[model samples]
Target: MYSGLMSTPERLIESTRELLWERGYVGTSPKAIQQHAGAGQGSMYHHFTGKPDLALAAIRRTAEQMRATAEAVLGGTGPAYARIEAYVLRERDVLKGCPVGRLTMDPDVIADDELRAPVTETLDWLRERLAAIVEEGCAQGEFTPGLDPQQVASTVVATVQGGYVLARSAGSPAAFDTAVRGLLALLAAARTPASAPAAS
Candidate 1:
């Protein structure tokens, strides 16, 4: 009677991704995924042995999406400061910690190496991508001469993550805005003349 006819496996995986985004690893269940996907238990079992299996697939999908997003934000066609600012200023729902970052708070995810790998990889890619941009800015005389790209990149990532935590904790977006503005100011300072000393 199901006429729309998306493949059962695809539907299950997609449903798992959504549930993971909404409730996280421990909060998600096979029944929830099945109900969301409109698939039967037998179909889900045929596709995945259990929640962990489904979660692994979802985690990989999330990691891939994060990488693609970084590439889009950090690559090509602008001054490095402008590009970094663009990346940071992209609209986001601050109260919902980054989908990938939220996994770090889930105990079940931290306990499972397979699950943790994708989360770690996604964050690493983001930090390295941002660092590369900062390094480019330094080389172009657009940023402080001795700015530590790795440290700055780490702070940028941490600020975004911490902003989410603060927003979720405080039940408001004000903290998120405060954190973002502070970061923008730091980046602006990096672009000042002292940051880009004239050649000897």
Candidate 2:
């Protein structure tokens, strides 16, 4: 029953990714995926061993795409602080929340190691990448000394994830904007150096 630009396997993966994003692992079903992909049960079974197997494939693909997107901004040319700021200020789907992070809230997915590995690894990679940048900024005096890179990285991640929650709760992006703005102000203030008095 699969006939489209994408092959049966590709359609299954792509459909699973969207369904997982829109409806977490627990909510997504094999029938729903088959329907979304316009594939029949036989086509789905031919491509994947089962729902979990297909879901893992979808989760991995989503995580990879997510990482690539983050790397585009974080790895761009600029001062470390600038890179971090750009990442923080990067445009996002405020209400939809993070794909990987959202998976963490899914009890079924989190309970299954195979399903959770990609999500956990992706987030860890992001945190470590951010920590590396923060450490570089501190070394370059872009930030005040004694600031912990890991702590700052974790805070940045938390702020973004928390912003999504806040935005969703309020039914608007205002809360998200407010959190980001406040964080940026703090970061800016932290980087400001105290000036010496003019010569008498």
TM-scores of all models?
0.90, 0.93
RMSD to native for every prediction? 3.8, 3.7
Off by over 4 Å in 2: 1-3, 192-200
Candidate models: Cα lDDT each: 0.85, 0.88
TM-score of 1: 0.90
Candidate 2 residue pairs that clash:
none
Rate residue 24 of model 2 by lDDT. Answer: 86
Off by over 4 Å in 1: 1-5, 194-200
